[model samples]
Target: MGTDKRHYKEPKTLPDKRNKRPPKRFRRWRLISSSKAVGRFPVLVETIFVEAIIPDLVITQISNGFLHGKIPAAHLPIVDRPHLLDTVVLCIAENPRFTAPITNVTAAVGREAILTCLVEDLGNFKVAWLRVDTQTILTIHNHVITKNHRIGVTHSEHKTWFLHIREIKATDKGWYMCQINTDPMKSQVGYLDVVVPPDILDYATSADIVTREGSNVNLHCKANGFPMPSITWKRETGEMIKLPNGREVANVEGNFLNLTRVSRQQMGPYLCIASNGVPPSVSKRIMLVIHFPPMVWIKNQLVGAYEGQQVTLECHLEAFPKSINYWINERGEMISQSNGRYEPLQKSHNYKTYMKLKIEHVSQSDYGKYKCIAKNALGETDGTIQLFAIPKPSKLLNGIDNDLQDQAGSLLQDKNYVNTASAASRKFICTNFLLVLSALHRLQ
Candidate 1:
């Protein structure tokens, strides 16, 4: 009766004054055991239980069984599952990439050259400019400008993209591409050369150039410019001339001017200036004149005969500018000249020009025709020679050998048979009969 005397009584719950703590109860079972001893043979004994505590509790018991989500049979070993987004996508696929190629380009036909392209990660780019054989679309995306009226794109307030070629022809020479899409490719290529300048076509002067009278004049100015044309010689009171001493004044290599030997106080009026640097410079003007003529005269009379007999001639003149004299008419007309004889020979030098008329011992009256007179101060001329006064041939062969013996004694009458030689011989009996027939024909 005492064992049945169990009193069970206890029921008191009150403490909910808006609660303060106590509210964590989730338990269904708990039991865990494990032991191992090899040398002593405690083979196996393992058990583990702790209900409902798995939020990933050993991966929810390895996803509840049959190696469900795998790994957890309990030899205790399993870990490996943290793929931070595939290791950041394989470290960005083993990084190393960049692209941009093309540089330094220039052009000049009508003139204007400036085309540059260079880029490297120009962040979020679309930048474009093309003409690569008229793809024509130049520049887009970054502020849209695609009207190639000779192209013009300049931005450097940190935007960088300059390609200005306003006026460049020859069909705008080729290849000008600058694109940037950037992924595995970005590009640049510039090459344009168009330069043309040189054209000048004609200029001239020269034909019988003569300048004398104090002497100094050279007028020759030619032109045709392209890369050549530069000649200057001036004097119209703008003086500049001293070219001559081996002369070679250049503007194309020595365009002559040697006013050194020219006086009349150096006459003026001359200009020859040609410029090829292009810009109006061309000139020509010439005027120079001077004259000369005066100095000549000679004439001194003289004539005589006999003494080997032969002489004749005359000459007379004064000075004013008309003269040219010379005559060795056998030497004898004293005025002044030497070496062809004419002594005391007056007049030394002043351009006596030269003159002649002389005769003093050229018997036979100095044989005819003699005269060469030339006068000046403007006028007078004459020339002639004629003189014959023979009588010297060994006294005319001794008077013709006494008139040929008085005409052979007036036509002989044998006049003693011309001195008797014949008459006396015929008497020699025909001279012994011709010397006895020439001695019998010389004894046959």
Candidate 2:
């Protein structure tokens, strides 16, 4: 078998190597070719077969297998989202700034004025107005613009801010502020000047003048102006008289002149001057008339009465002016004639004039008619009242004796004394005899 194996050939067949899987298509490839002699025994050999070709299988399957794109698992990364930077943006539509001079403004007591501010480049910002002295925020934004009714805010056509004041008063004169909500930056400031006008001269009417002697008189001066007017009084000699309390009497409260307890020397042409800071001072001259009634005269009267009785009498007086005065009459004489018994219930003063008399515990002596006499510088008046006296019980002796007799009889009956006093005395002397008789009686 070994000698024959030298020439014998096997039939040709594909090599087993071809049956093994080929390397990946992306790897290298090789080609194999074979030829055989016709008459000789068929020869067999193993060789590799490969072709260099485009990878068309995968491309063809992908193109023809599906309609469009395919969606993978949901684990995809996000690429687009919005991010927040700053939270809020504040902007002012207008910026307020201004300047005001101190000398130019003039305000009346009951008038109003405005302070103007130029606003520009606001840029979404909020604008507010405030009073500098009071630190009160007057307006906010475009609103007309204050919680206070006295203050108002207005915007001009040219974008200017104006502060309007109503009924301007003395206290309204001050500095004001134009504020914007720009932090770190301070608010703008403006000033206001209020000038008061001089008070006009007040005219004096006949009704405004009062005339009296040894009494108070009031003179009123009527004037009108931005500032209230002050009044002063001067005599023709340009001398100022000492007032009731010795203070300077030239100027009275409001526009008034007062003269207390007028005297003949005080009667003259008096000048009433009215002045306010603003204009020419004005004055008025008038003559003072003093007329009063005569002083009253009182007639010291007497009234008589017994003890334990009420007495009333009248005090007669004659005078120019009628006034009231009462008399305190006791016994037969006027107790008020001297300051010791009769005292003034009220003292006389510059304002009031009256006197009073009072008597308490009226007795029979006070029963006589007493009088209240009213006297004034002009005239006098008298009034009288009658009183009656009542006798005390001691004066009635007969009735007292009768009461004593009845009391003695009542005492005797209470004592049970049926025997006479002489009989009682005799029984005391016969006590031994009575005892013997008592024994005989007992035996019976």
Residue 15's lDDT within candidate 2 is 39
Tens digits of per-residue lDDT, candidate 1, 272-298, equal 666655456666665554333332222
Assess candidate 1 and give its lDDT. 0.42
User: What is the TM-score (0 to 1) of candidate 2?
Assistant: 0.31
Over the stretch 1-444, how does candidate 2's per-residue lDDT look in tens digits?
012333333424433442344335412212111121111221121122332112211110112322122222111111121121111111111223333322235666567888776666554556677878888778876775556678887776535777788888778888887776754443677777665654544344324343566878776666655566676667656656557775755444456566688764565567666677756667677667554443433222322233532232323333222344555443435445464333435444332344444434454334566555555654555555554442232332223346433433332332112122245543442353334334435544
Clashes of 1: 31
- Once fitted onto the true fold, the runs of candidate 1 whose alpha carbons sit more than 4 angstroms away are 1-108, 111-125, 129-246, 250-444
